[model samples]
Target chain A: MQKKSWNWNRFLACSEENMRNLQLQKLLERNSMSRSIEIERERETDGTKGCCKMEKGSSGYISEFLGSIPTFLRRCLFQVLSFGPIPHHIAFILDGNRRYARIHHLEAGMGHRYGFLALLSILKYCYELGVKYVTIYAFSIDNFKRKPDELQYLMDLILEKLEVVLSEENMVKQYGVKIDFLGNLKLFPEPIRKAAEKVMAATAQNNGTVLLVCVAYTSTDDIVHAIQGLYKEKQARIQQTAEGKQMGDDDEPVECSGGSNLEEFSVSSADLERHMYFAGYPDPDILIRSGGETRLSNFILWQSTFCLLNNPKALWPDISLWHLVWAILQYQRVRPFFEKKKRL
Target chain B: MGANRNGDDVTEINRIHLVGFFPNDLFQITSSWRLDIWNLVIRLCWFLLHQVFNTVHIMMGIKRVLESYFVPSGLLDEYKDLQLKKLRYLAVVVDSEEALQTLRIIKLLQWLSAIGVKHVSLYDMQGVLNKNKETILRSLSNSRLWEESHEKATFLNGGKMTLEFLSISDGREGIAKAASYLCSKYMKAKTLSGNQNERVFTESDVDIALKAVGCGGPEPDLLLIYGPARCHLGFPAWRMRYTELVHMGTLKSMKYGAVVKAIHKFLTVRQNYGK
Candidate 1:
């Protein structure tokens, strides 16, 4: 009986070894399968098709087929969003570029490069969604408070990017975008001011979209500027009136003249409106501030009265297409209220 | 039969030789397999944890929404003890969409009264509140919360609340009127002084002009916005130059907690008006 039991145990051990060997072979097969899938994904991202065949086996073929589905689905979603109610004007307060750099351990000024890329992507998306006007708070008047070196870097970056936008045929020529620098141009260096003028002049007749870059701008300053203009205009009118009175010294008062023409010399709201920096453009429909800050930071104060403010937590450079879509969705929900107010 | 056994032995030897040639490959394959299994287990655990977390979050969100629907008990008492600066003048700017709900406006006023806010300015973009001013005043007066002093009866009773209804027409138009008044005043002063080169107009001149025309209101210490957006919705710009704006979300979902939070936030903030 003991001998029979020993023989049975030996048989059990042999079967266990065979099972282990089978498991090893299965694992090897799965490893190769995953490796091929990784290679296929890389090939698809690279946009090089024939190079995918350089990988030995047909294992990646299935993954290559599956990877295309996501791209296809994304394209479909984009098309659907394009058909939705698009905001006519979108304002962006691009915040947190430096913070993003600090978090990522990137070199100083490298974040602005990434920020520029993000801006380009956003512009493309906005244009695709048929946004007519985009006002970006590129550089605030308070930004000059930064360290001199940092400010210099920012100025250089702005100049470099502005040059690119001017010379890049695909961007300006293809889109026919009108670029307007809305701020105190006198504060800028002569070269930058001249360059901005050249760009504005170049795109003066472009009828596609309007892009307003608020450089060295603050709402307080804009208001003060408008007030000064109104003050000057009022002074000019007073002088003209005095001169007219002097010239008509002996003429009798025209009794039949319209009373409306002799109305009091109070400045009208139209005078202030006409002198505003954004005189021609309609008020921004939506003001988006990234980095989760709630304050307006003195941006477009007069025009933001009826604007929908959307503050997404993502840093400016980290903002995604979904953030924009979500904002538009919120706008769509509140659009009826806006229309109702208009009608009333 | 012996020849057949030898052939089988040779095949076994070849298989062993292949394994020996790539020892690291076998080890790597087994390790990777272990890693894959470990990854699957981790992923499953994470998914389950995420689902549970998401459900809890949704439940909390629902609870908060429900809580906001009703004003919490003792909120007024708690607000009394709050360490805040004297908020003498309070301005509430409601979105036009919310202005249609008279009940909500009344409730907001009642809530403000409970919080011991004596002076309040109610603003709406389309002048809806201004249009319904009589009804709102009547409701407040009739309610037990407000007491009217018969001696000096005005739209706002002297007891606990003094309410002002404002609209967009009162904002920019008022400023323009004030500016016109100031211009005329400056011209008269200039003509009287007969000093064309001298600076006749000062900041105080503009202030006096605005006051003389009764075009400007006392600037609110804190401006609370109850709306779908964070914007002031064209609140009188002249009156809100230094006002601390606190967006309290939509009026439909107004919460006592949020109101207290806004006041607390206002108290903690330090404003530097171009110092």
Candidate 2:
């Protein structure tokens, strides 16, 4: 067939097929360039099977050669792909801990403990990756409905975990992480509550990372509490006005914070944000619900604005470094899109 | 001596290699000086045009692939409209801080309201009426929405909460309460038949219930859930069945824009496949 001249606008507007062709071409070029590394990654777990197919020189040699590339250039590439304005905060709906334990034929409490330990490791990685905030669904407010025995076991497990987390020698101190508990802590047993408090107090000075543990938490509860907080703020404002000798007995409207109209008394989004449990922290940048099922069980309601979602078909305790790496890669891929939006 | 034993095998391989002459030397141009830009341009144009033709030819094939991964930017724009226009009832689940979180919830609801969104229900499974009582009073002590939606939304503490009314004081009792709550509420709203202790308000109780409150009519057009699993594990089914669900990960990491986007995604969804 006779060929036509090139048009840039046409190329830009060229439908999905053209875009796919461009993507595929890039993929093929990248594949060819990284063929050696790809091969090594594939062989990493089953090294013996593909040992004979490796090139002359050890895997260490290849790694060294690759590492020789300037760190700056690597960073630039990473930035272009997935960098700053990245998910400042990431929340994990750590579900199926018990199921994971069951699959491995372990006890339920043991599963939760394992999950807690895994979460600690994940938090360390988040800090390392420069993530400023992390929220975990530790326990639900609804979970109080469980049998007394199961609840007791969970409480014990949480107490032990909190003690470990709050210990001076633990990762919380080692990494300078600030800890906060969400949901209704009042319902927890005294020991668990005290342990949770100690952890929060111990990590209070550490501003390097914000770790929000949703123990006895539910999104519905969080919203309701936020509303409750707002009400308190309103009453305080009214009391302040009254104490100032400015109380007009005519049922007059009272001025609130930031000079919002008293007649309207409507709360702005920004105003309401100031009263949330996560008032001081950044909104979650990415929300990952790890389980076969895809839904956001009452988790973070108000804070997940503009967050990238990564639903991996793996349970919470089953989550590993590999899953974290995959999630990061996905974050990196979508990071540019979000960054561009921010700039706009 | 061992090499001699493998001589035939080596010879057979060599024979296969040279069986047909390959075009290589003519195409091999080692030097940039010998490159032909004009000829390359012509070939490139030919390739480009061929691709354009191929793309235009298989339109549906291209659509399927794109739909599988990328939801186009244009569609996202449309999503904004769909989300804003569609009647959405966002269920913000909270526990003890129902009063505390209510301010933020109201802020979120007010934002949605400002955007012309119709319903914003902050469902507290834990009945956070104590600690949050001060917060709620503080937020709405002078607000108009408090006065207007006061009946629709109010503070409920441990005492006022009931299993029959879906007032779950804690997580343990939430599930059963939620299920029964959904069933009864949906049943009554649709004027459906109740158990022996109740009256049958309408014929085709199940169907009417499903339609009016279940997956049918009065169904929450969209349910943008926030919290733990991606599933709406605790949301009342009467509202969740046909509702488009979008999860906002957690509270500590909550962002403002994510709420907008979740609503946007829900509004843009095409099918409300059965409950």
Candidate 3:
């Protein structure tokens, strides 16, 4: 009986291996077919004059044919993924644009352009995956220490991309993506800051997705900002009470005197939270840092108490949709422990 | 632009263009076909190589797991070398489920002591280690290894090793205490100052509040997390602000090599402190 059971287990393993190999072969065949179709499309585009219309027709047909497989696969995978809990807010520490450019031997500013494109793709994927809030560490306050020329190029590139995104009607109107600049806007120069303001104002009414671009931001700076705001609030309250007292002195004394409540002055965690820049949004569920760095680098320090830190060894420009999918899958695995810890 | 010898050449080129579909272009078709086949062959070879490498890695992992049952002599020396930097304060955070094993805790403590760790803090999200603290200390004291004279068994060179136990409750309670202290301080200051319009509160007020409540502790130079996942598991945030967090994968599969690697990594790291 033991021998028979051992043989049965071996047979089951062998069959599983065979099934995997068969599926792999099928995937390879499909991939090759798609590659051939791409080559044919490229050949048509490179051909002489009369082939343009034919090229468009063939390309459209090939795209429709090729797109069906991924859409189908995505649908199936989405079904499985939807059954698990999804992260509501995801933060990204976009690192290694310069390193990516150096590795690819590209021009100084081109890597950031590619990184911006990758960000757009990831944002679309996250919104589609029902992630409501997406925060990106676009520009840190520390980044200003880079070379003057590179810094200028980055500022220009950011401005140009912001204008392009604002002009793209479908991105805002169709997707309902509200663009928010989540840092000290005063740090930026006039025209670029104005453009950022314009973009935010343009998408103010959209409620579908929130895209927080942390520019000139650091978590420590954010904490200091919150402290300053709280201090100002306390000062304002004191002034209001003093004014009210003066008014009471001039008129009939009121029963409820504001002076007696001076002993009740206190600061609460809620007060500090209310003064935070990210006050309304939920804390990030997952904080992904690309470029293989495991450090937080002063990004969202206070709010990431339970945030799952995912450090994938890929540059910002090299990030793809699967990285986001894998991060969500990891979040699902750890969600139980996180909930348990929170309950305790 | 080549000079054609006859009208046939011109007509031939025109026919070539007019035919549009080059069905007899064997060179073009075969070259692309060869390229496609080459790509497929390379991909297949890569896939096979990856599979072989993965199997070898799994075998190595299993071997490491089996070896973890005993403390090897080589690992002991390596861990001793790792302590050459003299890490003053080290914190080990284990998952709550893994912290239930009291024997494992004693073993880990003994290992740390043998490796010359001067001070160690054991932490878990649940207060299991905290609850079993007295038992753990008693067991260690009764053990022959720890019962040796203090002069002979001193850690790293001369100093005796000390152990501290912490839990999530300590951090949460500390924060709550600090918050209430800040509230009372703020109220007292407001009542003392008759001029309410003056901005009296400063950053030092919060600092003093936390300090008065004894909420702040000396930051750990290095924090090693032993768990199934890499999350911090709500380790005291205030203490770990600048701490180097290294995830030493699951406590059950803990390896000396990983601990050595984490210590080496910490030693080489040059933290700029947000410069």
Number of the predicted model whose DockQ against the real structure is largest: 1
Q: Report per-prediction Cα RMSD to one decimal.
A: 20.9, 23.1, 17.9
Candidate 2 residue lDDT tens string, B51-106? 45446535844553454234334444543454354553445544323234455654
User: DockQ numbers for every candidate?
Assistant: 0.11, 0.03, 0.07
TM-score of each model's B chain?
Answer: 0.65, 0.43, 0.63
Least accurate 10 contiguous residues by lDDT in model 2 chain A: A1-10
Model 3, B57-98: lDDT tens digits are 479667655544333445444333554464666788899899
Q: Write the per-residue lDDT of candidate 2 for residues A1-344, one digit (tens) a residue.
A: 00100121122222323333433444444456566655654565357335546664776578757754643343232222121223578899887777776776655566676566567557645654457788887777767777788888888878866775655434445456678997688988888888888888888887667888888776545544544455456545655775564545536443432233333444444554565577777767778877644445556644543466567778886786656655555454455544443453
lDDT of each residue in A171-235, candidate 3, tens digit only? 46555778888887889999989999989888888877799999988765665566567756765
**CA lDDT of A337 in candidate 3?**
69
Which pairs, if any, clash in model 1?
none
**Candidate 1 or 2, higher TM-score?**
1
By lDDT, rank the candidates, best first: 1, 3, 2
Docking class of 2: incorrect
Candidate 2 error regions (>4 Å): A1-86, A169-171, A246-263, A339-344, B1-275
- Candidate 3 has a TM-score of 0.69
Give the per-residue lDDT of model 1 (tens digit) for B1-275: 01111334433433332232335466346554554464344335434433554576469657766544442555445344656336767899998778899998998888777766767889998899989888888888633321233432342335557777788876777667766776665556565566676344443555566667765556777888888556687877666655766777678877776676566556665543321
